[model samples]
Target: MHDVVVAGAGPVGLFVACELALSGCSVLVLERDRDPRPPLKALPLGLRGLNAGSAETFYRRGLLEATMQASGAEAQEVGADPEAVEAPGPRALSHFAGMTLNAADVDTAALPYRLPSPAMEGFMTSLDAVTSVLTERASALGVEIVRDAPVTAVSQDDEGTVITAGGRQYRSRWLVGCDGGRSAVRRLAGFAFEGTEPLFTGYVAEVVLADPDQLPIGFHLTDSGMYLRTPFPGHLGLMDFDGGTFDRSQPLTREHLQAVLRRVSGVDVTLDEVRLASSFTDRAMQATTYRMGRVLLAGDAAHIHSPLGGQGLNLGVGDAMNLGWKLAATVRATAPDGLLDTYTTERHPVGAAVLDWSRAQVATMNPGPNAPALRKLVHDLMRTTDGTTQVYRQTSGLFAHYDLGDGSTLVGRSAPDFRFEDGTRLGDLLHNGRGVALDFTEGRALDGTAQRWAGRIAYAAGPVRNNLGFTALLIRPDGVVAWDAAHTPDRHAFERAAHQWFGAPSRLTTGAPSL
Candidate 1:
């Protein structure tokens, strides 16, 4: 029996399995898909939050960065490897399309960030690269990933959870459903997913343009649709689509791709090499709950939305990172059972927010009668510096702020990255553990308190960059500051919060001290 059995091997499931295994929990992942494939929805890694910069702190778990680097290297070898003779595809053209990334728009200092050449264009890679790397990592971490296991049923008892597929039953103290939106585990758990269904269908095709120069880095020819031409190691990334009705009964055809490009771009283009194409509908749905008994849900199984901003994969990957630690701590007997509840509280709103934002993005592209006027107004607004900045920030997932409940100063606000007296930045400190409490000002010296909750919390003295007047601050695992007290905090107040947040302040006394 595994400590936790994860259903599905998409980015989320794999990520969660990686985290759990890293945290020293035994994990088993079951995936139905053969592997990642070309024309797969997930595009190149953003590397936006690699350093946990001003973004929502989603991609800071460090696994994606490693995966991205390895993938890029493999792709580079595919294109530059002396043994290979095949030329890269058209997607490679957008490499020098001169893409622009405005740091100021992200509420950060104006600094230039170059999109990697391998990521922009070079070699062609499929989703297999991502899964393969993750699978290898999981295996190294002692995770057992079983493929072709299409789970059909899930049963939970007071003792644990049982999952059955192909007449094989696996039992575990906990069950994690990393499955996709149409999750069988969700159905078996009787969880209700509440949200809107997709009304529009999008057709996507992978092609090698005969003349890649025709494609720009990124351009929206029609307000209702866009023609994004990005470059990969050896090929160009060309995606053009607008909302349309869906007829899944009919296979997507090359003629349909030509018609859409012609109608939207007003250009008749022939496909140099039509590698892969498919039609997909967008839906905005989130589970009513994240857990049932010993069973838990993460990633697409918990929430799903339109891929307007390429947030589907990012969000799923973030979900895994968020849940992995909390669940590991609980199973390891370090965290209180109530700690698991915070996962839903913190992530549910995030999922809902994604749906809301992605819905608006899709709405802007709705090709209705009002589309022309709406498009004009949007264009006029976006032309402004302020509007352009706002749109850029919002669409890039840099402005998502979680409401950690109204309590004290900076409870919910994302903690501003600050420098410590020792010259350490908050982002630098987060690499160690969940959150830290830094008391630059003279607060109640957590003398015995330091020994109390050692592993879970840390206290250090430093000069905060913001000068927000908060002497003491409580940070969350995701690097968001939950509570800040400019003045010395009351010992009782801090203890009460510690009890509530981590559960059982008394445990701190008996547990091992944190680093």
Candidate 2:
């Protein structure tokens, strides 16, 4: 039996597969579609932004350059100067309800624990680019990906789960659902999906406009609704306050799109032909819990929200990053007590926050007498330094704080990419998919203490270029700071933290404890 059977072949599922396989767990990925590279995946043609946090995740896996290349992004645009002592202010910015922010307004000094690294700022890329890169990596890691296999039923016992997909039965120790918003696994597994209903129906389409100049480019909020026109020819995004009554299951007729477009844009726009189209609602929902017996959920399967603020892709990526190692450890029989449960405890809040963020934007953009006033106030606020910083913190995919309980300012946050004197970086050390105990003590304070966890954790002793007032720190395989020795190298505290996350150090004979 395989260690894990992952549902969905999208970025999250493939990424989880890669992570499990990296740690020596056999992973089988079942995809619902026959061809993974469907052209429609590139719909909404504009590049999807991978926030700094996601970029760092890619860097940890040594896939940053490949991802950037696939996305047609420049190496210089994706990160800061390698030899710099401090991180630069973010250069990329995200929009809230089509109202964009200026990156220059972000207050860099207010941000904490940021160190100069190759992956600093967010960049624009398509889903196709991301999926292709992950698929190649998953293949190299020996992950089995079977396409045209939609999961039909799921049954689990104390030992493992029997997944019925593609008219075949497969058994695995664990199962992870990374399917999209309408997740079959989620339905079959009987998880509660609860959320607020949408107030409007949103549409994105590529059409043949007879007179494109009739409507100027950029976001236009009308008395009726909101419509956005990108610089790309024929690209259009529309939001109509229809209370989400449009039948999404039915084919998107050109007449209906034109009528909705006219209602929202307040312009008599003519659509000669609609080459492609898709519909969505601001209806945000999330699974009450991520786990059900030996089966679990990740990505959209666990939480789903509108594509507003473009958090869907990034959020799913974060879920995969956080869940991958823990699940791998569980499959290997090396996970600490209750390690698997932490996946939902940590990620659920993040997902909820994103859903609320999306809802907030929708609220502001909702067409009504109060909308103009709301949008004006928000626009004014967003122009300020603090507001810009908050937006950057909210959307950049970095700055997510998982309360690891003790509340050390740095613990539970993404570890800084500490650089060694000889030029090796923490990102370099993390490429092997193992916990890292980076010690900057003069006498190697953590040397012997970290040795007991030898195979489970890689021990590195040296003064980094920027320790950020830390003498030593333990980073989980997912690059999250589990503990840090700020005042002194406290062996006992370090070991306790290690045990909490990495499970009783000592080579963890229970299958190498790769988490």
**Models, CA RMSD each:** 8.1, 2.8
In the range 455-507, model 1's lDDT, one tens digit per residue, is 66666564544455666667766666666666666556666556555555434
Worst 10 residues of 1 by lDDT: 89-98
Model 1 quality (TM-score): 0.78
Candidate with top lDDT is 2
Poorly placed runs, candidate 2 (over 4 Å): 43-46, 507-515
Give the number of the best model, judged by TM-score.
Answer: 2
Q: With candidate 1 superimposed using the best TM-score fit, by how many Å does residue 271's alpha carbon deviate from the native?
A: 2.1
Q: Write the per-residue lDDT of candidate 2 for residues 374-469, one digit (tens) a residue.
A: 889999998899998999999988799998897788888999889988888999888878999988877787777787787778888877788889
